[model samples]
Target: MRQKEIQLNSDELRSYIDSVGYEKDNLLEQLRKETQDLGDESIMQVGSSQGKLLEIICRIGNFNKCIELGVFTGYSSICIAKGINDEGRLFAIDISEKYTSIAKKYWEKSGLDHKITLILDEAINVLDTFIDDGLKGTFDFIFIDADKSNYIEYYKKSFDLIRSGGIIAIDNTIWKGKVFDNDDQTQSTKTIRDLNMLISNDPMVSQCIITMYDGMTLCLKK
Candidate 1:
């Protein structure tokens, strides 16, 4: 299978530099420093620019209902909340309450606690519950950055929960340039590759896979 790749070029670099310079998020900076204190593992997060792009998407999606499958320390969720928070609802799921609590503090400090909901459980299990609780087709946008083993399952579940035209953004699709190495059959890498193939041919989505920060696959349900 021939795979399409998104390469970040000089123009992209300049564009990002210009766009991200538009504001200084002091609180976000402070939170990053704090997360860094909890060992580098806990602080594993997307770049600041990606967080801000998520905010921009939230606004463009005009979405109050959003779902995030991974809440690693909450940096991305908080960054996302910054966008649709005024009249929106963001649900974050994770298995670690301890780390998510760390995320909570930042959300509280940033005055976004009221707008976001945190669920402390494995997202795969909680996903069905959210659906049974009437969340199916209720979300306008989604972000998935969770366990790589279940990436395909998560994508399928998200597709069911999202309405037509809703966008699903997935992180680490390229798995740090691992997808190209046929000999490197890491489970995580293969799973992502499979999902990419599936989504690429699926008639249901209009999509683009951007090779930014490991790689991000942005797909809109048709």
Candidate 2:
């Protein structure tokens, strides 16, 4: 028997998935519209399908202690917060007060403000602080969608902070298909490519790259 493979190669197919992939939440739709008003930076926000995927992952894992490395306008943060148990907490770190201010409003509108704690600081600094605070191997889930150049550093620190069996979800691993272009030796592209190679060969975790909105690499700590 021939195996069936589906490719999302057209606008119609993508739109179809957006329509039926998950239940639409009015709050998220409102947040998307608000983020879109930011012009080009709006692209930084996670797609609805990817947000739904994050929520599902947290729900399935019963994740309580979660960390979001980059909380741009808080779309993914909301999804993760909604997925975790009621008593769960999400540590959302971002350096942009202008952007995360929008996230804060939406978190309040979504009634998730109580569940998320926003930290305004460099991601590496915050990760180091978590380590210094004796948070090693204690987090349940970590979603990394920050600066591409520092992805490896973020992954290294996140790995130490996450408990065994926890997961680390890295977004934009495909780098908008730039990873396939050997000519593109840019810092961000090179970093993502290197990180992909590192994770694939590392015995510390089992990993899978899902071709969702952009691409998400899920690493389960061993």
Candidate 3:
């Protein structure tokens, strides 16, 4: 039997679902709200629904060693950490120390600080270091959420670092629905479109882009 389809097209309905279906722990919830209160930068933080989904994915995959590009206040990091095994660790890379400071506070508050290592440097450079250190195909999960222009490159690096059965979740593929607008030839949009196409055609992995928050493309390494 087909399951009933429910739509949360309205803001009110979506908000209700966000509050009810994925009520984050108090510390995480506060960090999310506080980040949003910071204005446009708040969009950098993934939605509560997306955060919850990441956690669920981690738990289901038994994903322990992980990498997250773009720590943005650490909201997603905390979610990922929550679902990981107690001994699991996440290497979070971001360019801004200012923003990660906030994440640090919340991680400490959540008692998850020890589980995450925040790297203050260029994401690509960090990925290069991982490869230099001979750490390929070792990560159980990898999340790419930074520098839209380098998304394809990030995906490529992630592909090499992720284990055969591991998963790579790339956020912001839809580009606020700009991928469908041909006139919008912004580099970010163009790069995202290219990355989506590359992932679609690549035989090394099977993937699907889910319509959630901005859009998350979940890829399973084969």
Candidate 4:
């Protein structure tokens, strides 16, 4: 059965956001522009709307200790930090020091450097360290937006990292809407699709997919 697929185009959506007074500061705008300069890699960056949603989630939940699996240029990192408690800390893990160096510059410019810790290493390794250090169930929020093929593994590990009633936001769950296209069996698409299904069926968490900006799956640990 096919579902009715109605959604605004990019221009219309941007216009709607503008009309609604979606505010963007120079720092975020500049970071976005710089990330865009990376060409296709820029697609890894989350949309402005997604960033705002993340910040809103942090605010409403009063999330303080957060973990972000991927810190591409730090756009979402800043957004998450903005809504966190004054003394909140964010652990951002990424494999690329080069990209994180760019993120570091903006993070300091935004005065968020003190709140964010950049770990340049494989996300899985860092997660293992968290477990080894007995830091399980210590985070208020966990944002997963790294290698698509490892999404399920990341989710499984992140589940153990967040506290009860905490949130885990998974990016690219819809995979540009490719999850619905059975013909598309690419590894990335398949993993995202499988992860979405896994979350939907998991009894330990309550979940929903925000359709805005690719798709972000918000899961609340029980």
Query: What are the lDDT figures for the candidates, one per model?
Result: 0.84, 0.95, 0.91, 0.91
Clash tally, candidates in order: 0, 0, 0, 0
Clashing pairs in 4: none
Model 1 C-alpha lDDT per residue in residues 73-134, reported as the tens digit of each score:
78889878888848888889988887788899999988998989998888888888877888
Per-residue alpha-carbon lDDT of candidate 4 for residues 38-87, written as tens digits (9 for 90 to 100): 89999899888789888999999999999999999999999999989989
RMSD of 3: 2.5
Candidate 2, residues 1-222: lDDT per residue as tens digits? Answer: 998777654687788988797889999999999999999999999989899999999999999999999999999999999999999999999999999999999999999899999999999999999999999999999999999999999999999999999999999998888898999999999999999999999899999999887899999999
- Most lDDT-accurate candidate: 2
Name every residue pair that clashes in candidate 2. Answer: none
Query: Candidate 3 lDDT (Cα, whole model)?
Result: 0.91
Choose 1 or 3, whichever is better by TM-score. Answer: 3
Give the winner by TM-score. Answer: 2
What is the TM-score of each predicted model, taking all chains together? 0.88, 0.96, 0.94, 0.94
Candidate 1: which stretches are off by over 4 Å?
1-22
* Residue-level lDDT for 171 in candidate 3: 97
Candidate 1 residue pairs in clash (backbone atoms < 3 Å): none
The TM-score of predicted model 2 comes to 0.96
Alpha-carbon deviation at 101 in model 3, angstroms: 0.4
